[model samples]
Target: MKVEDITSSEQAIALEDQHGAHNYHPLPAVLKKGKGVFVWDVENKKYYDFLSAYSAVNQGHCHPRIVNAMTKQAETITLTSRAFHNNVLGVFEKYATEYFDFDKLLPMNTGAEAVETAIKICRKWAYEKKGIAETEAQIVVFENNFHGRTTTIISFSNDEGARKNFGPYTPGFIKIAYDDTHSLEEILKENKNIAGVLIEPIQGEAGVYTPADSFIPKVKELCNAHNVLFMADEIQTGIARTGALLAVCGKCDCQGHCERQATYSRPDLLILGKALSGGAYPVSAVLADNEVMNVIQPGQHGSTFGGNPVAAAVAMEALEVVRDEKLAQNARKLGDLFRSELNRYIVDSSVVNLVRGRGLLNAIVINDAEDSSTAWDICVALKENGLLAKPTHGNIIRFAPPLVINEEQILDCVKIITDTLKQFEK
Candidate 1:
């Protein structure tokens, strides 16, 4: 059907089902507008945004400052392709490099592209700098990790659904148990051709499985000791969604340039996306110091719209919003309140097993089998009760609202969630 013909929610879903790729099974909500932490459907029914586009809309939807930047830049210029330098790319590079404490930044348009770029950089750095044989460098990745759907990125994924039939898959990846430092260290020690260790600070797609607090620091130590590059895929967990500026900054108060902070488990290469533009544009970046970032010279890698004018402008303002509004602090404060309130309710809960996560990146495991529809049913109930959330895995529901959400809204969401789960009591 034509765009004008798609008037109702059912029509929209039907159009997507009929015309678009059958890739995703989205919840049945036809959202028309969003502001702060609330979204309204086509029927004008308002609901709290609990998922935040998988933490993409961390700064809230249609963030005014980011939107203004995007509009102002788009009027003048948009994509200028890497053949000719744009006016804003350098400024963005300098601003972001310094903001994240990286000496250089390689901008990309999506989380997958950034991950691919990092893999290329890591492999090249190993061959050129670490003296490894070409194409023999194996990057260590974790089980249950979700970097992106790209073939190379998925090469390391353990999810059968994401990996099966997507091959003959890319090789040269070493998989280890998630959050297991011993196995990671053993792999690094046993394999001299290992180039980098890629990981998510919090495995968001694997039901927000936050490793032990000691897990990341130990991985960092082992990587350093074994002289392996540590690459953090913070696309889902970074940019203040996890309370701190980055999930690696565990409980850190320093808002800007977290690498210097002691608690920060710094990675040799940092991959970020989703909220980098405050969900205004596709802006993903890979950051590293000169020693690592400089490995990729001209013509080695780039994108036509990687560091476009609008992306640069939008991303700069997005970072500014995170700092100016102290979204990190807000996330931290509200995260504590959310967990405490949820934990209080969980004491009497049979539907919910437990709550686990740091800051706002959290999930509750349903007391049901992995193949069960309990979590999905609960999400539908949540939508019906004036909130919107979705299950990540079979029986795990992730609850990550925008960082801009206030305490009162959080409490209200908590009530809706608890009330919904209460209905599913076995």
Candidate 2:
């Protein structure tokens, strides 16, 4: 029962199954270590990491630069709280705001916190600036959206599993179908009390659902016309996961230049997390321009560990890695190879109905019932074949590897996936 006795993957898996709170049903293999695109199980079996910690490790696992920065900061100072200033915080804020082209950055520790912060900022702006009456500001959200797991977040979620027994929910949220601009526009036009429209440029959780190319620009226009704040929850899609710096960049095919102008769909508020620290540390932030971010005077919304020194140091290095390494460019190249290779098999295989996504953030739709266990079965088979992936919905499995992945590695992964699918067919 001791750690030494657990020399095999099964033993480690057994220990977790017995002691841990069954929050997640992970694949049977027990990951002992990871570097770049590969992970080693407890038994020393190697497998390609395809999830990238839900797109949080865009710069790869345990990136030396980010880890070194974190270690250096840890040796000096890790946490000072927001009561006093930390050297790294100001630098991180300045660097991040400039990197994201935002006027201000409110640092937090988790993705959900950033989302909550964005929500609070929008509400404050609605009341103070937009003249919305107290307790009457509504935010328009999309169906099948996965913002976070906070009570307030789940309150607006349409997923039964996420919302069941989680209510009576938080109010003032209107839900509409996703990818339907007309539905959003109709709601916005009729609901004069709407304060903001919070959306994911590409829905990550319900599956990597990329909206139409014009969706973001049109939504921004609608929000501007109605004086409603346009907020983007780029927690999973940001940080170059979608081949762009942000999914809203409207340059799915381009690497450096965006097809749409920067001002075309500039969000009033932006929520970021996951890869902000390159999976080295948990660092998330809410970004806003002066007018929107200035609503919160002080003591309104804060977290004790929100802007810790370790997070600040780690985030700065992580973002630097993204820019210096050109991870976005790498993701764009590898992602095209991944989807193009998969499409060849998908055209002939009944097991896979479709493969859709941008950059490294992609998913495969299994040709099975929504409640079927086909995707899970495929994932288990994939694990046996030296690749690691997980099913998001019942019939959808997302395959988002680290952005640091190379062409040879991607082609190898494609072979693993195609070979595995062929076995399933037999």
Candidate 3:
């Protein structure tokens, strides 16, 4: 079909359905433009963006600062293949390292790339620093984890759809139950060659499963005691999507009261993406202290698009936007309001089982079977009601708006959600 023939939303959806891979089953609305907390469908219908592109657009869509940096850098120079040092890469490295409080930063193009980089760094650290034998080091991962789609990443995934027929999978990954410190401790005790524990601060793809209050600190303690690297995949929960700059900072008592405390559960290796470029570009990084990062020498691991000038410029601005705008503080306040409103609605409705999350990264569990399409149906209603959201698993819908959303917009969204849920109640 010609481009001009695609005038209606149905025609656009049909084009994608026929031409594109069926990897995603998105909401029927065809978004054509977005700004701040709202997106416009092809038919010029406006809707509150509750999903925020899976927490990638935490700074809001088409953020001016980030886009300007990207555009200027693109005009000057974009890619240099990392063979030669680009001007923006070092600047970005310094900014990112300081921002994340890490000694070094390895830039990559996507969250999955950062995760893979962390895995390699951890394993190399085990072999070179800890003197573990080659090919014997194991990393512990939690069940229901959504690290990425790489062959090595899926090797540790427990989801049948992600793993089935994709293996013969990569080995040396120990799977344990999530949010269970005792299980991790037991695994650590049994495996002397354990390299690291990679975990998401909040499991976004697994339906925003925030662990117990002490889970992060306890995991840090165990990793320290066992001499294992504590790798945090903050790609989804980082960049102020949670209350704090990072979900690891959730331990900080600075809930609109004081500045962030210096002491916190510091991950040995930090994987960041998504909001790193504020959804303007694909930018991800793995941060580590000298000791852990030094394990990988030259030519150990690298990506061509990694640390490109455009990505570097965009990421630097994106992080600045996060701090300057105090997106974390906004997420915290709005998140509290969102949960409170949803909790009130839940008291009278049977369609929603519960609402749980930290900051703007939250999800509502449906009072239906795990594999049911009730959440999808509700999302259809949400789209009709001028709000857009998607289900993570089968019966759980994650409502993560951009951190740039205001109080009035949040209240408006809450009403949309409540009204939509009430319709499902009958």
Candidate 4:
């Protein structure tokens, strides 16, 4: 059958199972189109996109501004490679650096690549600037962190499924407990070879685990005291997903001038992705001031399509959408409402234990064991009831809708979610 003629969800699933890699186990709903806060399945069933493509569609699906920028740039010059100077690249770099209050930005194609780039920059800065011996720099990471699945990244991962048979792992990383400031302090005091401490402001894949408010500031203080680079991996929590422009912004949702906010704990190295292109295309970036960024000379690191014109245009427009729509403010206001509404329901709930998260990135913990299928079953039921969410770990379902969702829409979603949970109540 012709691809366009194949309209059934079963047909699409069978085709993927036959021709595609068996890597992802997606929801049964085969989506064919999406708008601001809604998606349509192949069968024309509509559902609220609670996942937002793992927080990549913060500007909403097929955002007109981002799409227009991408299409316009594609029409002119999609790629010139870093060999020749592209007009849009430098403009985007300047805009983004100023927007995020950084001095420089190193663009890449994916969140994983940006993370790897940050690692390279950190190690190089340690060797050249911090005076660490070559190959002796050790970076600290948190347990249950979800960076990406690159060989070097997965090497430090604790996920057995991702690590099994994927040895030997890369060295020079020290894993520590998440949200433990004392351990970080002890390690920083003991280890002089430490180059950087990489952390997610919120551990998204580990079930929207929001750390203590004091945790991030203490980490920044420790990194400052030890002369180590503090790298924040905001791939999933950035771009206003966490109520603020960046998760590290704490409670402030100011458009810019993050340094002026007392709640903001600035990271030396900032890694951003997912929503960088508003889910329109691949674009990720590593941002830092000149002192740390200058360590990498030209030809040391780059990608063929890293800073392409299309990516530049799309990313610029995407970030603009965030500011123009006041998505950070929207996320903050709605997130509080979301959690409050869920908490009210949880008081009498037997299936859901609690709801926790910042902004639109929230999760509900099922009262079942982590190995149980209860969360998955509820997610399937949510899909059937006109909402789309996914289970992480096993008993946790993350609910991060587009930042564009309104209060009325969110209330409707809450009803759908609560009604579905009632079906599985113990």
Candidate 5:
């Protein structure tokens, strides 16, 4: 059925429930349109988009530049499998590689695919370059790390719901405590067969969990010392969502796109997605230098629609929008304001326990049991109050508005959030 034919939200939701796979338990807000920092529901009720499509719309929803690029390219050519080169792929590769200061980029459709690509490269590098024995390469990962839902990616994940029953899992991953430098170092030191350390610079799905200020850099330093690949899954925390071009870039003030500053952690392999196409397309990439990325040959690793022209055009425009808009600087300034405001509210309220995050990526921990519906309840209330947000876990509501959000909108949204929380305060 067509959207215009479906008059009620219930009917739309009912159709989805009946036919769609039960993979997600999303809030019942059926979004029909989006622009900038706001989205309109099926009922035409506008709300501040606090989630930014899980940071995929960092350049803002339906950004004109990105959309125009996609549409214009769509009218021309969209996909030409890696079997033959498209007109735009090489241009995008050069643009992206130079922009991120990497020697090469392996394009993919989603964050999970990019992650899998990084894993393949890392493992191959381990055998061919590092000279590790065949089938002995182990990649160190952290607890509560959310890379993707793929079988191999989830093999290292500790989340019971995502990991349960799905495996007779893949092996060669060693899990360690997150944010613990000593544990990471010890694991790398003790385990010589380790090929890489896959980590989220900021654990977004694990409740917007930002690590110690020094954690990322130290992890990179250790990975270097141990001759292990430091693969940063920036697919969520990247693209100016975390107050920097890359979350591993720390809080550097450069908005013209990262140039390997002193503050940058400099991962050996960088996985990026989500915001790469500004929610305009499914575009993700794994970037590395010659030594590491060259591990895989032509036939070994390529995707049918990975570097297609449409993705290439959309991604370039999306990245250009990020730089031209000074998204990193804006995210930094607004994030500080958001946390400061939310922090003040948390101190006085019984419903909220704390707000922790960097830049636009922040989350509030509800003062309720992990199993309680309090956070979800708060989000529903937020929806009614002209804002939209969702809980990451049972008690954690992540608030990651688009980097384009103005100061007034941030404050307005914060008011709506705080006012709603008061209803549940003890």
Candidate 6:
């Protein structure tokens, strides 16, 4: 069959299996289009997009404002790499740095690259400013963290699947328990060579494990006491997904930047991605104050498409959509409703153990064993029942619909989700 004429989901899956690498084992539903919080499969069957492209579509899919900005810039000029300056890049950098209350911003094309950039900045700051010996500065990370799959990142990862064959792993990392401040303090006190403490306010990939309310505050305090940089990787949890501009904003629901909020736990290095361009384009960034960021000199780090005009325009518009549409406020209100409704059903549920997350980023732990296929089967059923979700770490399913979803849509999704889970109830 001609590729253009292929209309069946089976045909699409077969084509991918034949031509594509088996790096990702996605759900069987082959989606053709997306708008707002919904996606249409190849057969024209519509389903709620619970995953939101792993929280990349926080402003919703194919948002007109972001799309228009991208297309407009593409038509004007797409790329003028760092070998020379571009007009839009400076504008985006200024807007983004001001938006996040950072002194500077480093642009990159993907989450993994941003994480790598943060790592490089942390280590360089250690040597140049912190007075740590070269190659001796170590960054502390939490267990069950998902920073990305780069070699340096996987070196410190506990996931055997991602790390098993990808060694000899890079060194200079210390792993500690999540939400444990005593361990962090102990490590920092014991090791004067520590450069930074990297954390995810809510571990999205590790089954949406939300840390204690006091956990992050204490982390920032400890980092300050030890003079270590506090780095937050908010790739999946930022951009209104956590009901705030950034996950480190905690419970603050203000429409403005979180710098002045009492709940804000400002990070020295803030790594963001996924929804930065509203899923219209690939855009990720690392933000920092001058003290922590100025360590990197020219000819040190950059990407070919890092600050392309298209990325600049799309990201600026995407962030504007988040602010103007009040998505963070919406995510906060709906998240509470979503959890309340889910809890009403989970109280007596034998199939789901619990629900946990911040804002729209949430997960339900399956009662079955981690190695069991029950969660995957339930996800397939969810697709059939008119909603789409995917399982993580075998038995935990993440549900993060677009922030554009309204009360009625979220309630409808909750019903669909609870009803689907009821089918597998013991």
lDDT of 4 by residue, 182-221 (tens): 9999999999999999999999999999999999999999
Clashing pairs in 1: none
Q: For residues 1-426, what per-residue lDDT tens digits would candidate 6 score against the true structure?
A: 775687999999999999999989999999889999989988999999999999999999899999999989899999999999999999999999999999999999999999999999999999999999999999999999999999999999999999998899999999999999999989998999999999999999999999989999999999999999999999998988989999998987687467899889999999999999899999999999999999989999999999988999999999999999999999999999999999899999999999988889989999999999999999999999999999999999999999999999999999999999999997
lDDT of 1 at 199: 92
Off by over 4 Å in 5: none
Q: Which parts of model 6 are misplaced by more than 4 Å? A: 1-3
TM-score, per-candidate, Cα-based: 0.98, 0.97, 0.97, 0.99, 0.99, 0.99
Residue range 1-426, candidate 3, lDDT tens digits: 676566789999888899899987888998889999999987899999999889999999999888899899999998999889988899999988877778999999999999999999999999998989999999999999999999999999988888899988999999889999999998889889999999998999999999998898899999999999999999999888888888877646464222246536789998999999899999999999999988888898999999999999999999889888988888888899999999988998889989999999999999999888899999999999999999978999999999999999999999999989988895
Q: How far is candidate 6 from the true structure (C-alpha RMSD, Å)?
A: 0.9
Judge candidate 3 against the unseen true structure and give its global Cα lDDT, from 0 to 1: 0.90
Ten-residue stretch with the least lDDT total in model 3: 255-264
User: What is candidate 6's CA lDDT for residue 27?
Assistant: 96
lDDT tens digits, residue span 1-426, model 2: 566687887777777788898878888888878999999987889999999999999999889999999999999988888899988899989999988888999999999999999999999999999999999999999999999989999999988887899788999999988888898888887888999999999898898988888888899899999999999998999988878888888765555334255633778998999999999989999999999899888799999999999999999999889888888888888888899999988887978989999889999998899899888998999999999999987899999999999999999999999889887773
Give lDDT for model 2.
0.89
Cα lDDT, model 5, residue 392: 79
The pairs that clash in candidate 2 are none
- Model 5 residue pairs with clashes: none
Alpha-carbon shift of residue 19 in model 6 (angstroms): 1.2
- Each candidate: how many clashes? 0, 0, 0, 0, 0, 0
* Candidate structures ordered by lDDT, highest first: 4, 6, 5, 1, 3, 2
In candidate 2, which residue ranges exceed 4 Å CA deviation? 1-5, 252-264
* CA lDDT of every candidate: 0.91, 0.89, 0.90, 0.94, 0.91, 0.93
Per-residue lDDT for 376 in model 3?
A: 93
Please state the error at residue 149 of candidate 4 in Å: 0.4
